[model samples]
Target chain A: MSFLIGDGMTGGYGSADILHDCTIAVEKGEIAVIVGPNGAGKSTAMKAVFGMLPLRLGHVRLEGEDITALTPQARVAKGMAFVPQTQNVFTSLTVQENLEMGAYLRRDDIRGTMEQVFDLFPILGEKRRQPAGELSGGQRQQVAVGRALMTQPSVLMLDEPTAGVSPIVMDELFDRIIEVARTGIAILMVEQNARQALNIADRGYVLVQGENRYTDTGEALLANPDVRRSFLGG
Target chain B: MVDILNALVLFSNFVLIPGLAYGAQLALGALGVTLIYAVLRFSNFAHGDLMAFGTMATILVTWWFQSMGISFGVLPTALLALPFGIAIAAVMSLFMDRAVYSFYRKKRAAPVTFVIASVGVMFILNGVVRLIIGPDDQRFADGERFIVRARDFEAWSGLSEGLALRSTQAITLVVAILIVIALFWFLNRTRMGKAMRAYSDNEDLALLSGIDPARVVMVTWIIAAALATIAGVLYGLDKSFKPFTYFQLLLPIFAAAIVGGIGNPVGAIAGGFVIAFSEVTVTYAYKRFLGHLLPENLAPDGLVQLLSTDYKFAVSFVILVVVLLFRPTGLFRGKVI
Candidate 1:
């Protein structure tokens, strides 16, 4: 069994379903990437797994324990951290303050976790006192990811973490994400740069209109001629 | 030299001292307004009445204290009664939030809806304060009135004009400074305060981080109530307590908040002083002070005051309008209203 699973999920923002029987799962220390065309419900699948989307007809389980009814906040308490694609950082707050707020639920000392985040994103440490709003887009994304890591969550979820950054920053962020996964945390992220994302992904799911069209090992998915021709623009 | 010294004394006596005291009161009042705007994301029209309500509570307690022969000696007995007033105000604020504002908040109502709801609260609070305290002026200040008596100053300085500093004015400045310091410290250093700022900055992200919205809102109300109570008491001590005056004060208070940038605390303080000095300087009759400065022949006969004190609120209105027109985000780049 996967460490975390959103099995057969079906739901949407309202009556009209955005996700249909979508299944996404990630094992411990593995990176699972979700990618597809625009309006293909790729982000919806991630939201469903994170409990941000109300699942109408599916179950999510963490280590075989059902968590289908939990809220996003409650899921955070259960060791899941989500980095939103936009407005992810507290613009008015300093970078350090943003990290502190992420660890608000923890009673123990958060200094160590903050230090770890700084290690993961060293620029954040250098600009710790600067307000997150003052940073550039890529730096702001780093602050967002660093804030989520401060929670010391078992699973880290990102929604198109590299959506608007330059290609160089995107590669750097991907490298950082790989480093985070090496720390034995399950990483599930939606990516727009599908080729680069699959290059580092352990498993990849190709979503089409909220349904999984292809699920395979990252290397195998990259090599598949049909996936290359249709989705990867071969 | 004597003419210059007398003119300086006259300016300090009438304009500087009064402006400082008035500015301190407005700063405190505007701080409360700014905090609510920042965290709750609405302009609370009821804030002025809340101050009146808190002042009324303090006045009642002061009257009781006087009857019991309790006093602060050199300071007004109202100072001792302040905490009880603050507690009452805090409780009332929490109740108002829970009973009135929370419903709109739960509905995710628009900021305009919240503003209109606050107007309803303002009417209720205004009525309640008037009913309990009566519409008449209540002078609760009882202490050694003059920190620097005019006659004593004249004797000491040997000047035609004597600078008199009222104890209430001194206390107002002192207390206002202390409260501002404490508030800034709390906001910058404390954990709960950071949570409040984070919530104010980004509500969705704050929720995702597990910072409880209810707790932040409750704390914001409590702090705002405390500030309003303190400001009301100080202003009452400096002048006199009247429900109608406090109700009327809403204009200047809102003007101060808006002029300073609606949600910025530092801007509130700056805005308060700006409005105060502008009102005082514009309305002040420079007939006597000019006599000291200018040659006897050059000194004009008519009062040199540009505006009447009766139009003091208009100064704030003008400043508010000017600020909104030119820089809506305010002097400190606070959130635009």
Candidate 2:
């Protein structure tokens, strides 16, 4: 078993199973990208892992311990963090306050953790006093990530972190994600920009109809004809 | 220059002083409503009745204190009894939340569902308050009657128009300002308060950050209850406590909240003053106040009242309609709110 694993997961929001025997995993210091079409259950699988949606017939384990029954807030306390695709920041709060909220469960001083987050995204420090809502889209994304990093979690999940930003901003975010992974934190994210997402991904997952169609290295998936023709838009 | 000073004194006595006191009352009521809307995502139609219930509680304690010969010296004895009233109101709010609101919340019911439920609560609370205290007006204010008497003011200023300052009105203004400041400080500075703002801003994100929704809701209700009781007690001390009058206050309080931008606290205060000034200035028989400013030959003949005091409540309705027509999001544009 990898460090974080959603093994043989099968669930849907309603009665029918959207994720049919879907399995995804990531190790320490690895970046895993889930890429698929619009209705390919990319977000659903992530939600299932995060316990936002109850799984009917599956188990999710972190470090070989079952956590499928835990609620999202409980999961957060257990060193798991998820940043949603949209409305991810508390827009009314200052950038610094947003980061402080991320450390809600921590009993110890989080100043060191906050400084580390600021180091990863220095722009967040400059805009610390400004309300998150006033910041640009890319800058807001930085606030979101900075907030998540305040927890100093071992594993982080992101859903389409670069959904609406310009391409240059997207590349900058990907570079930061790479830096986060290099610090030995496992990264799992769903990506709308499949090509760019996979370019830096160590493990790439191609999901179709909520099931894993291709599970391989990013470079291997990029080189495969079937993956490029079908999902990758060859 | 003397005429100008007299005019200013008249305005202060009739409009500014009363408006500020009434504005503080309305502001507190609107704050309660706005907090409920922000955290629970409901209009809380029962808020006015809740105020009535809380004031009834305070009045009961004040009567008991009076019988025991206990007092707060020059201050109204009701001030000493306020905590009991706040506690009662807070418990009632918690009970209502658990028994009524939590069911619909768990069902993920529509906002309208909560509104209808609160209307039911409104009727129940109104009935309970009247049953306990009766519908007749009860004047619980005791101790010093006036901070500055009209005759004393007249002697001091040597002006024809006398400025009467009620102790209740003075206390209301000071207490309201302190409450507003403390509330803003809590919301902007404290961790729990910021968590509340964050939860109100985006619930899903707040939950993701490990902020418990249940705790937030509980805290919101408690704060709202405290505000309601204080506002009701102050207004009761300023005017008088009649269960029916409190039921009537619902319209104006809601108007204040909406006029200021429903979820914005600052807007609520601003809206309170707006509604208060409009109601007072419009309905007031301005003949005397204006006669002080105008030349004797130009003195008016009529009462010069824009609207009668009997239709003062309707003023809120009219303003509500105008505000809704012009700006649906409200004066502060609390669209996200």
Candidate 3:
């Protein structure tokens, strides 16, 4: 069974439906990547799972518990964290303060979790005292991810974490994400860099028009002629 | 040495001491304005009127306390009656928010709409205070008036100029500092304070992180009410309480809030002193101050005043205009409060 799953999500911003029978899931210790064209509801699917947008037709389950009716804060308490594509970090707060805010719900010790985050992104540790706004795009993304990690969640979701970063930074981020998955956390990520993302993803999902067009192992999706030509731009 | 000492005494009597007390009052008032702006995302035009209402409540309570033979010894009984004033103000503010501001908030109305609504509240509150307290000035301060008398100072220092330190001035300075320090501690060290800051920074993110917006708003109004009451009572103790006077004082209070950076607490305190110094120094007749520094021939006729005391509010106006024209975000550059 999947650790986290959004099975057959069907909803939109208002009256119109943007997603039609969309299903996505990630198992424990696996990295699942969602890749698609712009306006194809990539971020919307992520938002649905995070409880930002309500699903009209389907339920979201975290470890077999239905969380469809839960608020975002309730979801966070149930070991779920989501990092948006933009404005994901608290800009005015220092990197440490941002991390502290991420652990707002935790009543236990967060220092160890913070140390682990620092280990994942050493540059963040170096610039811990600096405001998150002062960091470069790559570093800011690290802070955003680091903040999410402070909650010590079993599942971590990223919406285009490497959207504006350099190619080198993107590779490094994927490597860190893999390391995080190795520690038994489920990762659900939406990426614009589909080819590179598929290189590291345990499972790859190709969403077109807010519906599942392709689903397979990352290596299989990368090797498929149709996916390579149509979706990955040959 | 003697000349310099005389100049120092004259400056302290006219500008330093009074400015310090007035600055404390304005700082507290501006702190309320800044907090409401930070949390509710609007400039609270009704803050000054809230102060008047709160102070009016405290004065009535003090009168009751006085008739009942209760006192704080050398301190004014108003000091002891402060919590009642704060409680009344908090209740009124929350009621106002529910009746007027909450509807617009639910509509996701613009900041300008809130400002207009607060103006409506301001008028209503003004009318209420005037109706209850009457339009005339009322002095409720009852205590040992001075810590050091002017005659005592002259005798002790043997200086040409005398300096008197009023009990109200000492209390104002001390109480303001304590409140500011406590506020800083609350915001920096407490979980709730950090949550409020998070809400101010990004509302959606704050919600995702589990910060309750209602709790933050309630705390903001409570703190603002308490600060406003203390500031108003202190000002009334130093000067006198007149409902219209607080309405007029709003200009300088806003000027201070804007100058220090509207959403920043520390900036509000600094801005308060800036406005106070500007008003006091500009309106003060500095002939005595200049006479101590310059020779008899150099000390020319006429008061060396930049502006008349009657136009003291004008000083704040010009400063506000200049600050807004140049740096609308204020000295601290908050997120457009």
Candidate 4:
């Protein structure tokens, strides 16, 4: 069974549906990437899965349990975490404090979890005491991901993780994501840099105007001439 | 030399000592205001009256304690009754949140609307407190009068100037410090305190991390109630309790809140001192202090006071205006919303 699934989801901010009949699924320990043209509801789909938006039709499930009516807090307790594209980190809080906040629900000691996140992003550990706002774009993204990792979520969702960073930094972020996937955590991320995203993705989803345009293994979508011309910049 | 000593005494009595006490009060009150702004995402205009309500509760309980012959020696009976006052205030705050504030929060009301609603709550609460306590000055501080008498100071130092420290004033200062220390410790060290900060920083994010908003709100109110009760009881003991005086107290408390960066605790404390000093010093007649420093001709005409005692609140208002104009976020750059 998939770790996370959004089945025939349709919803938006209000009456208008930004995600129309969108279906995406991520199995445990796999990296699923969603990429498309602007306004394709990439972020909206992620929001729907996380219960941030109203679902007019369809439902979301985690570990085969329906969560369509669950509040955001309920979703967190179910081992789900989401990191937005911008303002993702609490800038005022130190890096360590930010991570502690991610593990807010846990009654157990999170020192091991903190160590795991620090191991993934050594730069974060090096600057643990620094305010997140002071970090470089790449380091800030690391802090964002590290914060989500603190929850030890069953599935980690990120919207546009490398939206604004240098090419080298973006590559490094993707590598860290892969490293996170190796630890048996399912990852669902939306990416603006479509080609690179699909290249590293185990599975790729192409969305257009809130509808799924194509769903295939990352290699198949990369080789498809139609996808290359329309999404991947021919 | 004698004149300098006299001036120092004048400054200490009117500004330093009183400012410290008044600042402590404002600091506690503003901290609650800041917390509500941070966690509830609204400016609680009702905070001042809430403080009054807490103090009113304290007065009643203190009166009861006194009648029952319960005393804290020279510390005043109000000190013993404080916990009961705090409990009542906490219940009131939670009820206010559940009945009024939470509906607005659920509706995602505009922040301005929330501010207005708080004003409405303020008036309603003001009426309720008055109905229960009556709009009369109540002095439940039954104790010995002076910790240090003005005559004693004069005799001990052989200085013409004197520093009179009332038993209540001394108690107020000591209690206020203890409360401040306790509050800071809670905010920094406790789990609930951290959760409150998390919700304040970002509500959506907080929810995503499984931090319950309702629990945070409850905790915020509890701390706010404790602070308000302590501040109210102390202020009442120091001077006297008049429901009208609390409404008047709002001006300075808000001025202090605005001055310290609205969401910053340390800023609130600092702002309280700033407002207190300005209020006491601006309205203070500095003629005696300046007369010693200046030539006889320079000390002529009026009391050399920039403002009158009746206009003490004006001092705080002016400072607030100035701070808002130059730094709208506050002196400490609180949440810029």
lDDT of 1 at B112: 97
Q: What CA RMSD would candidate 1 show? A: 0.9
In model 1 chain B, which range of ten residues has the least summed lDDT?
Answer: B328-337
Clashes per model (N, Cα, C within 3 A): 0, 0, 0, 0
What is candidate 4's lDDT per residue for B115-225, written digit by digit as tens?
A: 999999899889999899899988777778887888999999888889988887777778878877887787767777777777777776777777888888888889888
Across B95-168, the per-residue lDDT of candidate 2 in tens digits comes to: 99999999999999999999999999999998999889899999999889998998999999898878999999
Error of 3 at B94 (Å): 2.1
What would the per-residue lDDT of candidate 1 be over residues A56-172, giving only the tens digit for each residue?
Answer: 899999999999999999999999999999999999899999999999999999999999999889999999999999999999999999999888999999999998999999999
Q: What TM value does chain B of candidate 2 have?
A: 0.98
**Distance from true position, residue A196, model 3, in Å?**
1.4
lDDT of 4 at B312: 85
Judged by DockQ cut-offs, is candidate 1 incorrect, acceptable, medium or high?
Answer: high
Candidate 1 stretches with Cα past 4 Å from truth are none
Among these predictions, the greatest DockQ belongs to 1
Reference contact recovery of candidate 1: 0.93
Ten-residue stretch with the least lDDT total in model 4 chain B? B187-196
lDDT of 1 by residue, B1-337 (tens): 9999999999999999999999999999999999999999999999999999999999999999999999999999999999999999999999999889999999999999999999999999999998897899889999899999999999998888888999999999999999999999999999999999999999999999999999999999999999999999999999998988998888888888888888899989998888889889999999999999999999979999999989988898888889989988888777864
Ordered list by DockQ, greatest first: 1, 2, 4, 3
Quote the positional error of residue A122 for candidate 1 in Å: 1.4
User: For candidate 2, what is the DockQ?
Assistant: 0.88
Interface RMSD of each: 0.5, 0.7, 1.1, 1.3
For each candidate, what is chain B's TM-score? 0.99, 0.98, 0.98, 0.96
lDDT, candidate 3, A1-234, per-residue tens: 688999999999899989898999999999999998888898899899988887889989999999999988899999998888888888877888888889888889988999999999999999999988999999999998998888888999999999999999998999999999999999999999999999999999999999999999999999999999998999
